[model samples]
Target chain A: MKRIKSKTAIVAIVFSLAGPLSAGESLPIRNCTWCHGSSAQGFSTAPRLAGQREKYIENQLLSFSAHIRDNPLSQQYMWGATANLSPEAMRDFAAYFSSLPPKAANDGDPQLAAQGRAIYELGIAEANVAACLVCHGPNAEGIREIPRLGGLSHAYLKRRLEQWGQGFHAAAEPMPQITRALSPNEIDALASYLSFVAYESLE
Target chain B: MKVIGLRLALPAAVLALVLSAPSRADEMGGPGFSSQELRAKLDYCKTCHGLSGQGYRGYFPMPRLAGQQPKYLENQLRAFYERRRSNPVMANVAHALSPSMVAALAAHFKDLNTNPIGGAPKEPVALGKTIYELGLPEANIPACSACHGPEAKGQGEIPRLAGQLFPYTVKTLGNWSKERGQGPAKDDTSFIMAATTHNLTQAQVAAIAAYVGSLR
Candidate 1:
């Protein structure tokens, strides 16, 4: 009797550790967490989904399935992930991930942060670069369909910016044109600066 | 000897006229800008203002310059430059523009007639139309059509209200006194709107903004 009770308690602990999955026809969140990390904070090349704009994530999922976001990593990973998702599933995932609190990566070069801040705030007007704050919001919190940029990983942000200039993700308007104007050093500065920014600190 | 001097004087006079003609033209239009320079500048403007100058909704709503009166556009640019308008970005942009470049840009934008990028709430539209067409007599407001023309196309220094962005109009009307006529010198036109803006309630302003924004 004692052995049987211990066995039942162990099983219960294991089940609780796994957490409860959402009821209904939606895909298991583990399918995304395997690559996105258990916390949805992101891992490797996958970006942090937590605290991202819900509409932006939903739009990107649709873009992936449609083959519009054709960057190499997206093709290799997100395309398959989003391929068979229903509209409701997409909305559910977007709402779920975006609701999670985000932590700043804080992974940038301290020396270059000031230059990056200046570029982000005011832009290099002489070079015809429009200020990022005009579209990205003052604290980089994003609005409506725009994605939050403050706490995304440096590598991910850098890759995305570079991809725009490389002719991938051509459908994201104004970005292709905007990124084309940024030099490699400027891209580094921007990505580095953004990685270190804590969204809460600014708020 | 008189004939010899007359021949010398005639060539000198002709040469002087030929040399001064280009400079006089430059004086009239400010300085000459190459087509390439003008095109580049226009693209820069479009980055903030929409591609067709139709206006854009960024974190801040950029106003439509397309089909606007060149005089009004020029006056605003001058206002930005003179610190009469308190927009840091526009001040930076306006400061870089030569008078001829400003004229070229104004002319270029004035020719672009595009549809309004509409996104305002629909409920207030009818009320907006009424307010735009007929002023509230008890509130001492005059009909907007009186100055903006029946179609809101505006004349001289008055801006074209047709197809202006909803948020841009709202922000402009709400902050009229704070943002405009800010320089040491008085701006007569901006002053005229100050009393009118002060009198209208927030709802009335939204109605007018919505009505005008819906116009093509």
Candidate 2:
């Protein structure tokens, strides 16, 4: 009888521990966590969905559905992930992921941070580059539809910036125009600087 | 000795010519930006100010410069340069612009007639229209139309309020005393709206902003 009681307790403990993951099983969030980190912090190719702007994530999901955000990685992974995703599902997923706490990638050259900060704050006016802070916020904490740029991975940020310059997300106005103004060195600096930024909470 | 002197003279002359070449646009023509230079500067302005100078909602609301009065534009630019307007971004931007460049930019933006990027809450629009047209006499506020013109297209140093961003107008009027009239030594036209801004309630200000912001 004591052995039977211990088995039931163990089963209860397992179920309790598995609650969050099982919740995703019903919501298809498991598919996302497969590419994105288990905690939605992001993995190799996928970006951190945690602490992202819900609106921005929704917009990107819609963009992916429409094939508007045609970057190579986006085309490969996100396109399939977001395809046929219902509006309700999109909203739920965006809300869930964005609510999660984010961790900084912290994978950038430390030396280039200052130069990146300068460009992000003031922009290279001679090059007609607008300040990134004007839209991205003081600490790169975005508001409303603007995605939170702080703590995004260096590789992801750099690629997005480069892709914009290369004419991938043409419909994402101001970014394409803005990125066109950024030089290669400036892009590298900005990516490096943004990668190291750690935020305590969601914007 | 003659050959060495000739070589040195040639290189020195070349260096002098290169060094003396006009580095800035204003240097090319006495106190004026050349056409190419003006075009480049306009592009810079548009990067933040919108392609048509219609203004944009960035981290901060970039005000609508399109169809703005040239005098107002020039004054604001000078205000930024002089620290009367305490905006770090605009201060740096304005410092780079010379008098002629300012003039050229002002003229360029004044000619633009883009549609408003309307995204204000429409529920209070009617109340806003009323406040804009008929001021609260009890509160000692004059009808905005009286000075801003019936259409809110301001004259001279007064700014054009039509199609201005709702948030920008609200912020400007709400923080009028703080942001503008900062230079006690140099009181400018921003004082014209000081009493009105002070008298208007937050709701009233929002209404007025919403009304004028949606106009053309």
Candidate 3:
């Protein structure tokens, strides 16, 4: 795992040095596209950044730089990818990516979508799960520093929720507290529902 | 032989009395809910209210529950269940709580003495303080201290204004008549503030909200 990270870091550094040859020009889009996908649609383990909240992307980039987002993938990939990025460059990257239209992953169980919708909208009050819409918005379009959860892959959404409870990234306050109340079934329902949410891009 | 039988019967009677005793003070809900169960419920409340019950800034502002009067808390819970208060999420939450659970939850939040969350604008604070203490007599607004208490800690069903979330207070005061006192049959305590809330302008409400929200 360490070897792979070092190699990725070396390639990232080389890419940074070889970038498009002018300050304030287009961000080295290729450097990110290599793993984030040619269209920035997220490939393999990478989370989709397209049409995400600009402030959220900026905050996450800062989190990477500060080593505050300590999730395994964030530690392995994003730390190196963002390590050499200047604050101006990070802001530019975030702004550029946030404007692009995002596609729904649509990769969760179809049968679970209804249950997920119920949980997201109403929450399981008897179980003490607060409605996700209270903070995430009715359509799961996040505000400000909160990332948009709509149309993210089920695996990505599920893992992020589970990781908070597992004590991975402690910096995202209230998430650890919030997600702790969700049962495993609730998580699956939420992930499934969110995966199917139709994209509503705010250009 | 009869004396021996009497002696044995006396011990049996004492054992029966011990078995039928009311039980320990802290063991609420008897065998129904453990201390762990109550703690879980408290954690749930804290998720939006903040870990220390200091309030939080979600998409919709969640009010501070720390240092709230237990009577006020319990009344609000019952109000939510009874539809006298009009928050859909809270209504659902209140519906699920039993009377004992409501009492336990209310008492639990009342004792938490966390600091104010503190996000109100500083510009209006002085004006807010003046309004809070002195009121706009020309406007016929009674001093808030008269009802909310000097420190805004509140009494009985009035609810504590101290350390409340600015937005929550603003929304509550702004939408007082629309949201609260809706059930015609149950007039409730919210009506006491209806005329006051009605007479206060938006600026005055903001000022009062900012002032009280800054209290410890």
Best by DockQ: 3
DockQ of each: 0.17, 0.23, 0.25
TM-score of each: 0.85, 0.85, 0.84
Per-residue CA lDDT of candidate 3, range A1-203, in tens? 97577557545644554645477545687788789876677888888888788999999999998988878999999899889999998898888777666799999999999999998887788898888877787788887887888989899999999987777666577786678778888899899999988775422
Encode model 3's per-residue lDDT on B65-98: one tens digit a residue: 9989989888888788888888778888888877
List, residue by residue over B53-133, the lDDT tens digit for candidate 2: 888898789888999999999999899888888887777788788787787678667777899999887888999888788
Ranking by lDDT: 1, 3, 2
Off by over 4 Å in 2: A1-24, A201-203, B1-34
Q: Write the per-residue lDDT of candidate 2 for residues A1-203, one digit (tens) a residue.
A: 97577557545644554666553354667788888987788888789998898988888899999888888898888888888899888988887777666788888788999999998888877667788999889888887789888888998899999987666777676687688778888899999999888886433
How should the candidates be ordered by DockQ, best one leading?
3, 2, 1
Q: Candidates' lDDT values, in order?
A: 0.81, 0.80, 0.81
Question: Each candidate's interface RMSD, rounded to one decimal?
Answer: 16.7, 13.2, 15.8
Candidate 3: how close is chain B to the reference, as a TM-score? Answer: 0.85
Q: Which of candidates 2 and 3 reaches a greater TM-score?
A: 2
Worst 10 residues of 2 chain A by lDDT: A9-18
lDDT tens digits, residue span B15-61, model 1? 45334555533433446665546555676787778867998888789
- How well does candidate 1 score on lDDT at residue A199? 65
